[model samples]
Structures are given as C-alpha cells and as structure tokens.
Target chain A: MPDAGPPGRRPRAAPAGRAASLRRQLFFWLLPVAGVALFVSALADYLVARDAASQAHDQGLLDAATTYAERVQLSPQGVPRDMPAVAQRMLLAEPDDRVFFRLVDANGIVAAGGAGLPDDLPDGSAEAPAFFDLGEGQQRLRGVAMRFEAGGRPFRLAVATTTRKRDRLMAEVLLGMAVPEALVFMMTGLLLAFGIRRGLAPIAPLRREIARRSHSDLDPLDMAPVPEEIRPVVAEINDLFARLDRALRAQRDFVADAAHQLRTPVAGLLAQVEAAERAAAARPLGAAELAGVAATARRLSRLVAQLLALARAEPGAPLPMEDLDLAEVVREGAEEWLPRAFAHDVDIQFDLARTPLTGSRIALREMLANLVDNAMRHGGPGGRIRIGCHPADGEARIVVEDAGPGIAPGDRERVLERFCRLPGAHPDGSGLGLAIVRAVVARHGGDIRLGESALGGLAVDIRLPAPAP
Target chain B: MRDARLLLIEDDQALADGLSRSLRQDGCQVAAAVTAAEAKALVGSRAFDVIVLDLGLPDGDGREVLAHLQQLGKDTPVLVLSARDGLDERVGLLDLGADDYVVKPAAVDEIRARVRAMLRRRRARTGQTVTLGRLTLDPQARRAYVDAEPLTLTARELAALEFLAARADRIVTKDDLLAGLYGGDRDVSENAVEKLISRIRARVEPAGVQLRVVRGLGYYLQTGDA
Candidate 1:
C-alpha cells in the first residue's frame, strides 16, 4: 500500500512558525549540496592543474627540441654541425631553463653534437620524432630525438632538458591557479551552511506554538507572520480544528439537551408524588386529581426510558460492537417485536441476506427496534411491516418498510432531529427514536436514509461498512 | 390524617404546589424544598418517611442530596425525580443509593408506586425475589427458579428478570431495562440489552420458561402458567 506514506516525509500539518523548522530544513538541504559543490570544485581544480602541468612539460620539451633541430645543420658527409657561439648565446639567453643539443649520423655516432646522447638510442629519420626521459643520480632530463635529411643524407638531432626544473616551474603555475579555488570552495560551503541555518530559524516558533496547545483547544491556528511557504498547511490544520470544535460543541449540546429534557418528566413525577402524599395526609384526594397525577407520572416514566435509550446512542457511549451475522440480528429484532406488532395487528416479516457485519450488535438491534417502533406508532393498527437485509458488492444493506403512512419527502430529514415529533402525530412518543437511530448509524459510520416503503409506509435503508475478513 | 411526613425536593413551584396538595390529600406531612440546598437543610433539620428528591436543583444536584442522605446513615428511601430521562442520570442517582427514580411530568400514581416500592424494599430485604407466571425469583438469594427447577441467572439476568416480573405483562422499553440493569457507570444500548435478553431467553426458554419480547414497547413476562 505504498508503504503507508513516505517514511521520512515532513508531517502534513506543520506548525505556523517556520523559523526553527526552516533553519533545520536549511541545514538538512544545504549541508549536502554545499559538500557536493566543494567536492566538485576541488575535483575540477585538480583536473585542470594536472592537465596544465602535463601541457607545461610537453611544451618545454617541444621548445628545446625545436631549438636543437633548427640550429643543427648537416655537412656533406651527413654529419650535424653545431651553430656558432653567437647563435648559442641567443638560444641560451633564458639561463634558468638549461638546454642540451646533439647530432648523430646513420652510424648512430655523435658526429657533431655533444656527448650527452645515449649510444643505444632507437633509430628514426625525418618524420619520426620521439621523447624519452634520462635519469642521472637525482637529476632527470626529458629528451626529444628527431631525424632530418640535409645535403642528400640523413642526420639525427636530440635535445634534452632537466624534467625536475620543468616540474618545479609547472608546480608553481598550478599552485597559483588552485589556491584561490580551494579557498573559495571552503568559504562557500561554510557560508551555505550558515545561510541555511539562518533561513530555517522561524520553524522553532511554530513548533512551540503547536506544542503549547491542550487537546481541548480547537481554535484556529494563528497563522499571521508565518512564512508564505508554510501558510497553506497551517490554514488547512486550523480549518480542521474549527470543524472539530463545532462537531464537539454540537455533541455536547445534544447531550446537555437530552439530559435536560429527560429530567423534566422524572421531576414532574417526584413533585406530583409529594403533592399526592401531602394531599392524602391533609384531606382525601379527588378523582380528577388522582387521575391527572397518575397519568402524568406514567408518561414521565416512559419519556425517561426513551430519553435514556437515545442517550445511549451518543458517541463514546457503550454499544458493544461485535462480529454479527446481519440476518440473525434482523431475525432476532423482528422476533422480539413480533408480539407487539401482532397486538397492533401489524404483520412483520423478514427477508435477510445472512451477511455478517462488524458493529455493535446492540446498536444494530436498537436501530432495528426504532424502525419497528416508528412503524407501529405512525403506521397505526393493521399496518404491515417488512424487514430485509442483503449483501451487495462490498457492503451490507438493511431496509425496514411499512405498509402505512410513509413520511413526506421534505419531512424525512427533519424527523431525524431530536424531539421533532411530527405535527399532529401520536402524543405517546418521546420524539427521540429517529434521532437515536441516526446517532447510532453515525457512530457505526453508516448511512441512513428514509424513503417510500414498498408497503406504502416508511422505509429506512441503512448501509454499514463492509466487515473485515 | 396528615400523620405521614413526606419530604418534597423539587425546583418547580407550580408542580411542587400541585404535588403538595395531592400528597396532603394522600395523608402525609409534606415538607417542600425548592432547591437541593433547601432539601439538604430539610434533611439535616427533620426526619421523613420518603424523600422525593429532584435530580435537577438550583444549588446542587438531587443525586448529591441522595448521597448526603446516604452519608447520614438514615434509612430514608429517596425517590429521585428529574426532567431528564437519559439512562446515565437515572442510573447514576439509583446507583448513588436513591431507592427509586421517576422521570419528569410523571403521574402522581407513578411517583407513589416508586415511593411505595422503595419503602417496601427498605422495610424488608426478605422479599428480594419476585415471581411472575412460571418464573420464580428469590431476590435475597439472588436466584430465579422456573418450574421448580433452578435456572442459573447472572446478577444482571436476575435484575432483568426481576424487572420484567415486577411489571409482569406490562411493556418495559429497552431504555428502562438498561437503566435497571447497568445503571449509570455503563451506558448500554437497548439492542445490546435485547440481545442479552435474547441470550437469556435462549437459556431460560428451554425449561418451558416463556420470556416474550414486545417489538416496539419492550419485553413482558406474562402471568400465565403456559
């Protein structure tokens, strides 16, 4: 399932203040980037320095080799002759860079050049040129030998210079090019880290704001002064809080109203009994007084009972949820209500799907009971009632239908309100059954709707969440 | 006449006045308190046979009065009266030791019946058991026997059976059944209790004990041998 969510993702709801979080985020994001940049810069500098040093070595060798090839001339016998001392002066004008020169004949002998040439060197003519390094103690020379034709004969010329001196010069040039880059790399990384930390400093205030709240505080978050990047999430969280606050308030009010309403009947009864006892002690009670007191008290008891049942359907109230066979629940609820229906001449029948569901079995029954109760109260005598449950797709559906006075389309929703007994309906009801049913349905995360029944009475269709395997 | 001392704790003046007149005619010395505080004062000051305590009072709750009365060690049976019929409130007061309870707008007779039941319960713990039809109950023994054979009943089962037997043949809704069974600490649905009843019926009906459930109203244990 996509692993629930990204394991290291930031929480969906970030606090309003982003300073501290931003600072942390800056540290999180910029540290690696700065490190990468520093590494890349260092690599580029190293590569460039290595290439420059190699080029310097090759160029210096080529320069010395070119001087020897250009100055040495071949005699009639193919012997290479050195230039006059004047030409050598011009060539050796740059004294720090020492140069060596040699010329050899076909016999591989030093015909005219200096004794620096190695006798066993490999042979080559005109177009072929080669470079080799010669080591003498701690000193090394890079030599380039090339063959040339003069006066109809072949002659070879070789030039050599100390590689150590070349390398030292190349090293100085490379260091000059690399020093600034390395310093800049280090500085940039440190600066980036500091900038990231500074940028993310606001998040700490946001975290504090969130951590300071109590669970009961559902007020909207104070989003002012939050960074623009984080405002949307804060707004969404605050909106959720606002909604939750309203829902909680409604629930509290509902309970309070229920408690307040139900207490009236019980209180009335107490008051009446006190009156009756005192009246009997002082003088004999009249028939009217006795009947009035007795009838009201009975109604009070019935009302209290109904109110209590409705309250039990409230959220967080105990409705022992169990894995139940839906068909069985319907059957049992039907059987229990059968006698009452029979007394009222209401024919109650059931057609069930036998689908097992997960819910408070009691709540399911109460929901059924209320439906049956409503049918009896409004459907009047001789009304026929039908109960059915069926499994469709991935959900279970339960329907209760009656063959009498179905509710009007407009009033169907209204009747679910507490104490909203229909106008001109039977007075015996406590006016909370449907409300209780709705509450129970809501608690079970089910949906309930009233419509015209097949029997021409009310039909309550409830769909509950599919049971887990 | 006027020898029975009746303590009246009610918040409503009109209802209180009417009840005072009715109880006077019923032959009792009536002391009416307007609030729970007043009721407390009355309880501290005088003794009465029955205390009709209202659950909703101006200064304090009627359940508080019931608790205080219980703390006093006085055996005065209290009948809690409240306009609210939520099972929790009724069960709470009852659990707190109020002997009986009646919802508001009650007929004086229901008040008298509850009061009488409490008085009767207080006078003797011997008649704890109740019998209706083929069902036999031993309230003190906390046992029920059907057809002379002992039927094992849990405390709740016994209370349900007892409640049904007490009002034998009359309709008792699921809400009242729950209130009478679990009281205030646990808020159980009528359907859950009905299931319990169903299970109880499954257990008790095998022995020819008939516990019939009325669809909309509640269950009834008929007073017939069959």
Candidate 2:
C-alpha cells in the first residue's frame, strides 16, 4: 500500500523512474521548437537585407563609371585622353569612402586614373555594366567595368570605391531585423512556461482535497473543478472511496452485533454461576443448575467459534486453496454431525460421489458443518435429513435437505444476513450459522439457494465451480 | 498415571485458575504459568509428565517455551491450546513437536480427556486394560465383564466392543468399525456389523451398559454413570 502522508505535508516523491512533471514536459517540448523557428526566419531576413544592400551599392558604382566614361575623349587612333583633374575630383567625391576610376584601352594598358583597377568586361553590352570586387582586406573595393567605342575602337572604363558605406548599411539591416525577433522569441518561451503551469493548476486542488481529509473520512471527492482529461480517473477514485465506506460501515455494524450477541450468553452464564454459588451456600448445587451453567458456556463457545469462522470466510480474507474432493468434505461433515442428529432423532443419509473442486478445505468444511447444523435445528425430531454431493452441469453440487418446516420463499434471502433470526427461532441458535455458510460460499465463488425440499423442509442447494479439466 | 505431573501455561488468569482446579480434580498434579517466561522457568526447574500450553502469552509466544523444552532435551508431550483454529496453525504446531492442538473455548472435559489420551499413548506398550464405570475390557484375554462377571461373546463381537470401548466418548463411524473388525474383508457388509452390535447390545444392556446407535453415523458405547 502507498503511504498517504500526514495532512499539510507535501506528498512523498514518486518512486524512481516514474516521476513525471507535465509542466516541465510541455515546456521542454515546446520552447526548443519555437526557438528553432525564430532562428530560421531571422537568418532568412539577414540574407535578404544583405542582398538588397549590395544591389544599391553596385548601382552607385555603375553611375560613377558611366560619368567617367563620358568625360574621356578618344582620338581616331583609339588613344584615350586623360580626364580633367577638377572634373575627376567632382565625380569621385564622397564621405567615409575613397573612389577611384580608370579608362583602359582594349590592349589592357593603364590608360588613366588609379592603376590596378579590375578591367573584367561585362558579358552583356556596355549599357549593362557588371560589378566586381578588387583588392584585399581593408583596401577591398566594389567596382563596375563597362566598354565603349570611340572612333570605332573599344575602350574600357572602371570605377571602384572603398566598401565602408555598404558594410555600414548591412550592419544596420542586421541590427534592425535580429533584435526584435530575439525579444519575441524570449517572450514566447516565457509565455509557454507560464501557460503550462496554469494548465496544470487544477491538480493542486485535487491533491489538497485528498491530503486534507481525515483517515475515516471516506466521502467521495467533488468533481466539479476537475479537468475533462482526468475526470475518469477521479471518478474511479470516488468509486473506490464509496466501496471502502460501505465495507467500513459493515465492519462496524458486525462488531456491534457480535458484541451484543456475545453479551447475552455471557450474561446468562454469569447469572447461572451466581445463582449456583448462592444455591451452594444453602446446600450443594443441584445437578440441574450445574447443567444450566454448562449449557450457557457451551452456547457462548459455539458462538465464538462461529464468529471466527465467519470472519475467516469474509471476502478478501486469505484463503489457501487446494484440490479436494467435495464428497469427502461432505462425509466428514456428516460424521461430525451424526451425534447431534442422533440426539435430535433425525435420520441422515448420504448420496456422496467424487466431486472434485479447488477450494479451501477448512472453509468448505465449515460451510458443510453449518448446513448440517441448520438442518438439524429446523428438521426437528424424527425428521429425515438427506445430504447429497455430485458433479452436475460443470459444477460440484451439494444438497442438504430436511423433513421439517421449510422457510417461506420471501424470507429465504433475508435469513442469510448475520443475526437475522426468524421470528420464534429456537432459543439455542446464535443466528450466525447460515450467514457463515453464505459467506463461505460467496468467498469460494459459489452460489447457494434456499428452497422447499421434497422432504418438506428447507433445502440448501450449493453449487461450487469445478476445477478446469 | 493417577498422579501425573502436568503444566498449564495460559495467560488468562481466571481461565488458568479454573483449568488447573479442574485438572487437579481429575487426579493429576497441575502447575500453572501465566507467561512464557514463567513457563520456561518452571520447565527448567522440574519435570512434568504433560504440558498444556496456550499459544498466546503476555511476555512471549508459547512456541518459545516449546523450543526451550526442546533445547533442554525434554520429551514431555505438549498440548497446544490457541484461539487460532486454522488447519495450517494446527498442522504447524503439530509439526513443531506438539502432541496435539485444541482450539480455545474448548470444554475442560475435552482438554482433560486429551491429556489423558496423550499419557495413555506414551505408556501404550504395556497394553493396559480400559475401564469405563462398571464395564471393563481385557484386550489380552479378548474378554469383557460387568461387575466382574464375564459375558459370552464371539470373536467379532469382542473386537467391535473393544473398538467402541476404546473410543468411549467419541462417535465411531460404521466404516471405522468395519475396518477394525474385518480389516478389508469385502464380503462382510455393514449390515453384518449392525446385527453384531445388536447381539452385543442385548447382552450389554442388561448389565447397565448401552451400545448406542447414532443414526447416519455409527455407534457409541455408554457405560452407565460414566
């Protein structure tokens, strides 16, 4: 049994390898997926911004190359004239960057302006100039090269600028796109953690309701606040509590009934002993008075024994089952009760057969004993009591019938209850015999029926399941 | 066996006192102990012919006393008395070397009779004659007498009488008598035993003895006034 800890204390930790926190599991499952999604989208945004920034910077280089190309004057022999220094300075003016230009003849000579400019011509016509990078490290520049014809000879013009402005623009786009996305990602993770905790909040009240209850408080838990997913679980717990409550009440009532039943015989025994003592003071106690005391003691002893048998036969009691022949159990019972039958002037006959079953020997013996006892009590003097055992319809059947007054059909069911004696019952009966029989029968998963016998008395028909073939 | 020494270890004060008084009246010297410790002390100090031990005791279990007696190499028979009447408990106690087990709430007469039976079994090699009231049987001679007068009986009748007399207070089944008299002879029916009992009853009844028939069981011999 799991320990139900004391009130106001946290429940003990679950056994190793079984601990599961739903809140942590949900957060763990959700947060990483959200983080990866945010990361992929942010990376795409950075790439798009970088592409747009480079396109704008390359367009400015193309404009500068076109302006420098217009300034060049070429002789008919295809020798390009150098640009005026003032005009060159005006075209290359810029802040935070240095600009360079070159006009090269088709022979690949350094025609004008700064040397070492890349002269890679565009694959398309001169109207569609191509952009390229030149130099290394901090001197890296973006340049565009184009071809033009003067006097029917091809000449190339190149313009390049240091890349500081383009680098600054890319950095701006990265800062603008990544910072807010990261904030949103962190915010979503926090919300997910909080949401999971709130989603699982209903379990707290259920736990508290259970922990706050006293041991004897077996009331069903209130289900209004329970979540839909766990309602079935709570309902099951409530069902168990209801069963426990019923069993507890039955136990309490049985104890009270037993006490009362025990008191009657004990009180009689004490009274008889006191009377005998008083009588002895006058003279020796008479044999009749002595017999009275003995009778009371015997009744008390029988009651105690019956009560023990009933307790042992109660449901959930440990029963040690073995393969046994029911006919043998019946025979033993008949032999044990034969003396009583003789005293009552009742004739007992047996029709025993080998009826094999799996059952507790002691309990089955007790059951048969009670049946015979009941038969004799009601069968009266000179009554014929018939006991039969055999296998019928895949079950071991035992029938005990008497030739005396039988119970009415309506009252048959009521007599199986503990201490439910019929009106005007024999004074000697403790009213527990049939109840013990019923309990034993029920424990063995057998069925019992009380009906009018062919002999004119009650017939207790018992059917116990036979062992599997 | 008249003055056999007996020890009774029971925790209930009133029960112990009453039982001891009754056993003493039955012609035995009975010593009483209220706890396991006291029982062990008494067992170590003296020899008892029989011991009636209750399983439940205040200081310890009655089994401890049984174990203690075993350690001392005492072979005195122990009759266990307990409220636990389960078959397993009875078998376990007997396996633990107890001579017998009787459930509690038992009649004092029953206990006395069991103690006497144990004593008789211990000395059974002598084959002592059994006497109940005026009816006595001399098994060695295959004879029975009432008031010291021998009654004429055949071999089968004598055997049946002796069997019933030996188990006087208990009801003997017809099968038990058949086995005792005929010893697996299938030709002899139970009806033959019934006729034999009637013949014995006719002779014994005039001598103030009864060969009582318990219907559906077997027979019991009631010696007059016993």
Q: How much lDDT does each candidate structure score?
A: 0.70, 0.81
Regions of model 1 farther than 4 Å from truth: A1-25, A38-59, A69-102, A110-141, A148-153, A170-182, A201-228, A283-321, A334-347, A381-383, A454-456, A465-469, B1-226
Clashing pairs in 2: none
- Isolated chain A: TM-score per model? 0.74, 0.73
**Candidate 2, residues B123-184: lDDT per residue as tens digits?**
33235566655666787887878879987888888777777766654567778887888885
The chain B TM-scores of all candidates, as shown, are: 0.54, 0.73
Local accuracy of candidate 2 as per-residue lDDT tens digits, A237-260: 999999999988988898899999
Indicate the residue-level lDDT of B99 in model 2. 82
Residue B76 shift from truth in candidate 2, angstroms: 5.2
Task: Tell me the tens digit of each residue's lDDT in model 1 across A251-313.
Answer: 788768777876877677678778888888989987766676667766766666666666677
Q: DockQ score for model 1, please?
A: 0.06
Q: In model 2, what lDDT does residue B188 have?
A: 88
Over all chains combined, what TM-score does candidate 1 have? 0.58
Which candidate has the highest TM-score of all? 2
